[model samples]
Structures are given as C-alpha cells and as structure tokens.
Target: MDRISQLPDELLLRILSLLPTSKDVVDTMVLSKRWKFLWMFVPRLLYDDSHQDIDYGRFSRFVDRSLILYKAPALETLHFKLGKICGAGDLHVWIRAADKFSVRELIIEIDSSSRASPAILPRSLYTESSMLVTLKLNNAILLDVSSSVSFPSLKTLRLVSVTYPGNEFVNSLLSNCHALQDLVVDQCPDDNVTILTVKVASLKSLALHTSDDRVEDFAHGFMIDAPNLECFHLRDGTGGFCVIENDMPNIVDAYIDVSYALPRTILSCITSVQHLDLCLLTTEVFFLLQLRVVVLTIAYENISVSVRLLILQDAYPVSSIFPCLVRLKICTCETEWLNLLMRVLKDSHKLQALELGRHHNRGGNVYWSEPSSVPECVSGNLETLEWLDYEGREEEKQVASYFLRFGSCLKKVTIKPESTSYDRDKLVMIKELSFLPRSSPACQISFD
Candidate 1:
C-alpha cells in the first residue's frame, strides 16, 4: 500500500497538473489504481512533438483519443506545438474540440520545417471563441475570416509569422476584439496586406514588425490609428511608408527600429512621447521629416525627455530640434557625426546627460573638426558623459578634450576603450585628457 497513492483525489490531481505534457499526466495512471482516471479530469492539455521516437500517426491518434475521453468540465488551457504528420490530420478538428471545452487560453505553434501546407485555421476560431482570454498563434495561416468575427473576453493576442487574407480581414479581426489590450503582429506579410491598417481603440500596447528580406514590396505601407494606446513599438524592415492617423495622447513611450527612416507623418503623432528609442538605417531620415520636432514640442508643457538613437547616415539632429531633450544615447561611426553632435549640444537647451559609442563594424579613419564656439550644454546643465569603444584616434581625442575643457556642471566622464586598443595608447589618451581644463572643478574622468 503506497502512502502517496492514498492521497486525496484533489491533491493527486493537483500533482498531475504540474506535469509538462498530457502524455506525462496519462502515464501516471500506471503508478497506482487511484491515478487511473485522475488525469482525465485535469483542466489543462499541452500536446507537443516532444517525444521524437513516437510516430506522427500514433501521436495523432493519442491526442484524438485523449480529447474524446477527457471528462474535464472546463479546459483552462490548451497548447499544441505540432510537427507534420504526412496526412495525419488537420488542426481544425483539435481546435474545435478545444472550443467545445471552453478553453480560456489557447496557444498553437507550428513547425515550419515540415513541408506540409500551413495549417488553415477554422472559422470557428475567430467567430466562436468568446471564452478565450489569451490567444497566441505562430506560423499559421489566418484566412479571410467572417465580418462577424468576435472575441469578447480576449485581452492579449500574439500572431507571429502568420499569413493573413487581407487588410479587411485584419481590420475585422482587430475591431471585433472588444476587450483586447495587448497585441503583437510580426512578419505577417501577404499579397493583399500592402496597407496594413490597425484601428483598435481598446488596445493599450501594440508591437508591429515586418519580416526581414521580404521578397515582395509593400506598395502602400502601414497605417495605425490606436488612440488609447499607451506604448507603441515598431520594427519594419520592409522599407515601406508608415503612417499614424490618430493623436496618441496616452502614449508614454515608443521604440522604433526600421530599415529606413520614418517620415514626418509617423513622427508627428508620437511627439507626445516622453521616452523614445529610434534605430534607423540613415541619419538623413530625420531630415526627411516634414516638420521639425523642435517646432512640434512648443505647444506642450516644458517636459524632460530621453532618447536613444542608432543611426547609420553619419549625421545628427539639427540644432534646436530637440530643445527639451535632456538625456541622449547615440551610436554611430560616421566621421562627420560630430558636426551633428555639436549641433545637438548647441541646440538642446535642457540637455543633461550624453552617451556616445560605435556599435557597428564600420571601419575607416575618422576626422574631427574644431568647433568655432562651445555648445550651451558645456557651459550649463551637461553633467555625465560616457564613450564606449574608444580607440585613441585623433578625432576621438579632440572631441574628448573639447568636452573636458568646457563642460561646467559635468560630474563624470567615463571612457571604455576598444578591446583592440593598445595599453600604451590608452595611457597616452588618459594623460592627454587629464591636462584639459574642466569648467567644473568636481568633475572626475575615468578610463576603462
């Protein structure tokens, strides 16, 4: 008589719930007579191709039998990570079975290596799953769904590498999610989705990323009109035009990474953002904005802001463009980047902290120019400055000397030399920077 087998039915079921897959739960039946039927009552099912030796047909049959025999009143979660089964079956049947059980959370992940056709989702998945709170689909085809599609309780949805029917279906799908708060759409490229428009009002957070190296070009672009959204993120490598039609007053932060720079239409809507991270293919992208960002901020209250910019065009923002920008991190190697840097230092009136670094593999000799005048930040609010991958180049030394000479309120200057830099060169750089006259007597300079 095993004492563990004598545990209460509720306690034994709880123990089985911790197992990773439904197969493990079923295997527990052999441990004792009491556990023979306890797994059938578990409220969760996780089926995956974890056991490699098992043939696809046998696994498919097991799943079919298990779902039919499941006596649970409600399935709180149903997850499937499936591999190709050579005409083994369609996923629509399994999804329908889960729908009958009122599954609250459903996750389906498909193996792309399988040569079989992508899973064609059932219409019931979009129109009937009112009880679902979270739904995530990966590598699946979402066909042209009904206009009446709805998910009354869904709060979070993630679709990655999913093929959509068209913009209308995408719009219809989003509009029907009455309670959707968080959404992520990545690499969902389709011929009919040239103008990907998302107009969800109830959405609080959203992330959109176009696929890398898309074979086809997007003729129109991407459009979004989420008024109540608080956070927005976008990574588009398609080089398509992106437009935001609504004023996102509730948005507190935004992160953008694109193969091309964003046009003014997209930037203007997110000017209300307090924190921003922009990664662009070229610095000329900023100049492409129709309205200067400096002019847009005048209407808002004087606010402090932080920005991280990864630009490749060897250019920087124009003077007065970032009047309220207080903190900035820039990664660039264009020898001419300092000109833009000087303009930023001269224009950002409230600027306090700055960080500079080389984050790319671009290699070439760099040139620096001696500016005619000191930037306003050097005389007033500028405080902390850090530089990474310092190589003791002449241009780098000149810039460092300029900062050490004029930064009045500066509290610290940290330099992290590149791994390829020689110790003798680093010593020389430290000695050269030490002699420069600092406007702030308390400022400390350290090298790493």
Candidate 2:
C-alpha cells in the first residue's frame, strides 16, 4: 500500500479525482501518512456547505493554507456552494486563489436569501480568457462586464436568479461566449432589464423560464439567429411567444407554452420540427397545417356551454391540424365533451394510438358522471385504446361497450381505474369481449 501511494503524482491525482468533494478525499488521510498528501494533488476542488458546519474564519484560513501547501498549478475545477454562513468576501478570496491555479470549470451558488450586490469578478479571472470552459452562477449578480469581456473557450453557461445591468449585458455575454453551445436562464431578475436579444451562431440548445410579468415584454418579441439549434424550450410566457425568424432546416424538437391568444402565424415559422408539445386555448381561425407527431394539451376552467360551442366553431378542425398524426392524447376535466371531440377524430385514418384521461383536481372533490357511448366512427383506425381514471360504474360500462362494438381494429384495450372496486357487470362485459379473436375483430380488454 505504501508503494502504491508512492506512485507518480499524476496517478495519485487521478485516484483522488474519483472522490466527489475535497473533504471526502481529505478523509483518506486516516489511511496512511502518504495518503495525507495525495489529496493535495487532486485537480478538482469541491466545497459543499451542507456537508459540514463550516466556520468562516477557519475555512478562510484552511483555504489559504491549502493553496500554499499545494503550490503546484494543477486545479481544474472549483465548485463551491455557499450557504447562509459564508459571505461574498470569503467567496471572492477562494475564486481568486482558483484563478491562480487556472481552473477550467467554475460553479458558484449562493444561498437563496443572500441578496448581496453583484461583485465584479477579479480582472485576471474574468479577462484572462484561459482554459475556463464552463461557468454556472445561481442566485448571484454579474456587474460591469464590458461588451468586450469575451470567453472564447466557454461552451455552456447557466444563470438562475441572476441580475444583470440590462439587455445589453445579456447580449454582450452571449457575444463574448462565441463557442457557447447551450444557454439556460431561469427566474432571472428583470428590474433594471431593458432589452434581451440572442445572436449566437453555434448555440444548439436554449431554455428560457421568465417571470409572468416579464413574459410578454422580455420573451415575446425576440430573434434567434442560431441556424444549428436543435432543441428549444420556452416556458411560462404569455402573448403567443414566437421564434425569432431563422432558417433552421435541421431543427427537430421544440416545446412552447404561452398564452391562449398567440396567433397561428407563430407556428408558420417552424415547418421542419418533428416533435412538438404545446398547450393552447382553441382558436376560431383555423390555419391549415399538418404535424407528423404532436402532443397537444388544452386547458380551461369553468367552461360554459356557449364557450364550448365557440370552441367547436373556430378551433382547428382535428382532421386538418393533425392530418398525419399517428398518436393522440386527450386530457380534460370534461369527459362529457369527449363524445363530440372523438367524432372529429373518427375520420383520421392514420391515428394508431389513443389516450384519454381526466385531469386530477387537487383541492376539490372529483365528481364522476356516466360518460355517453362512443360514436360509431370513433374506433376503426385505432389499434390501441387507453382510458384513464375509470371508475368501474355502469356508465363506464356503457362507454366501454361502445368501444367493443366499433373498435374492431383495436389490438389492446386498457382501463385504468382510480380504485379497485370493479363493477361485476363491467367485468363480465369485458370478459365476453376479450374472448373474441383478432380474425373476428373483437376488442381484447384488460382492467387495472
């Protein structure tokens, strides 16, 4: 063991890197005298406040001592999460020491309650433009970074609850990080915010989660110039968020959640996307379009009969919106409205899978009413049918009976009940249908 510990410093450093944090590596000092010094050579430094009752005074001294003891320039990563006990000055000192060692990745997280004003990063650390490849800052502030503060080697940046000077601050950050491929910003403060723009060419993935108040002003009207972007996610925004006009012929996946009033013209900008998830209020004006694979969720509260009629009038006809859709999922609180909606899908010959579920109400009681039978046109093209929240009631039996009669092509039918009390009549009805063979085109049913 002693001989093993005496191996070259590089080999010992690689062994210490396997430990998650510096303290964990330090604990190995009890193994032998040689192991005490082995951890000092590890290239990665991790400080997690939750793991220890850190004394700021002692911690400051320990960090300074550690830096002096391990004089070699070897650190590659410095990850620190400051809890309520640490102050900004303590963090500043450690960051400066890590910069001297040429750390490549810097991850700093401040306590959620720590509202200290943003500190200006040290001149050498921010402006040196060394091997720093990734930077992540959470619940902190970034102040006074000039438009020329470029990080040519940085590839990924994530900011959460961070306050910047203005939109130009964000624009300048993106411009400097030319090699950035992934950018994520969530819950960033917009008090002094003026403008936000994205003009990165190499960016491939972007996620924006903004405050409800700033959703329209900050997120709605923006342009993205990344042609190679493949994955894009926008959340909690209103006023029909639209993509900045770009020719991303290679774009394949996207998720957009915005207000009900967004115009259909926003979707026209994305013609090549293959996977899409959206939640919207039904509109009266139907702009004819087709999707190969789509998961659409519609939500409303206290819908009235008149509103329902309006939805039937202007909502994009199911046939035209998903003409080539192979899978369909419908989630709603109004099960009574399913009969009318299924009638529109009956003509969609390409639909192979169908899922229907009722939304679970949190605080209020869930009232289950008898659902009417499926229309004759509801089942021929579907091979699979899943009914969620089934309550094994006589009304549920009537709904199942309609599927048995019309869903001749169904290979499997699953009924997921919220409870285990199976209605004897429903079980008998299902058993009778399950005995029928596919050649005879009888529905095979299962209950869970």
In terms of lDDT, which candidate is strongest? 1
Worst 10-residue lDDT window for candidate 1 reads: 303-312
Prediction RMSDs, each to the true structure: 7.8, 8.8
Q: What TM-score quantifies how close candidate 1 is to the native fold? A: 0.74
Q: Candidate 2: which stretches are off by over 4 Å?
A: 1-15, 18-20, 50-53, 70-74, 85-90, 113-125, 189-191, 211-221, 238-240, 263-266, 282-448
| Model 1 C-alpha lDDT per residue in residues 1-448, reported as the tens digit of each score | 4887888877877877889998999998787777788899987788886345667888888988999999988998899877664231347678788778999999988776763555667776876677899999987777674467789999999998888887778878888888899999887545356667788889999998877646434233567878998888887756555667677777766776554434344445665554455444444434543123333323333221211122122223332245456775555554345654566567566778888775456533445777888777777888999988888777778788788778889999999888788888888888878887887899999988
lDDT of 2 by residue, 1-448 (tens): 7787779878887888888877787778788877867777788877766434666567667666766676556577888776545655666677777667877788887666543444334434466545678888877666665436787888888887777767777777787788999888775545354334678899988876666556343123344677788777766443322335466655556555444233233344444554444433332212211110011112323222332232223222233333444555544343233442354355345667776664333111223443365433354467787877665555555555656566667778887765544577557655654554443155566776
TM-score of structure candidate 2: 0.66
Give the per-residue Cα lDDT of candidate 2 at 166.
71
Q: Ten residues in a row with the worst lDDT in model 2?
A: 288-297
| Pairs of residues at least 3 apart in sequence or in different chains that clash in candidate 1 | none
C-alpha lDDT of residue 122 in model 2? 42
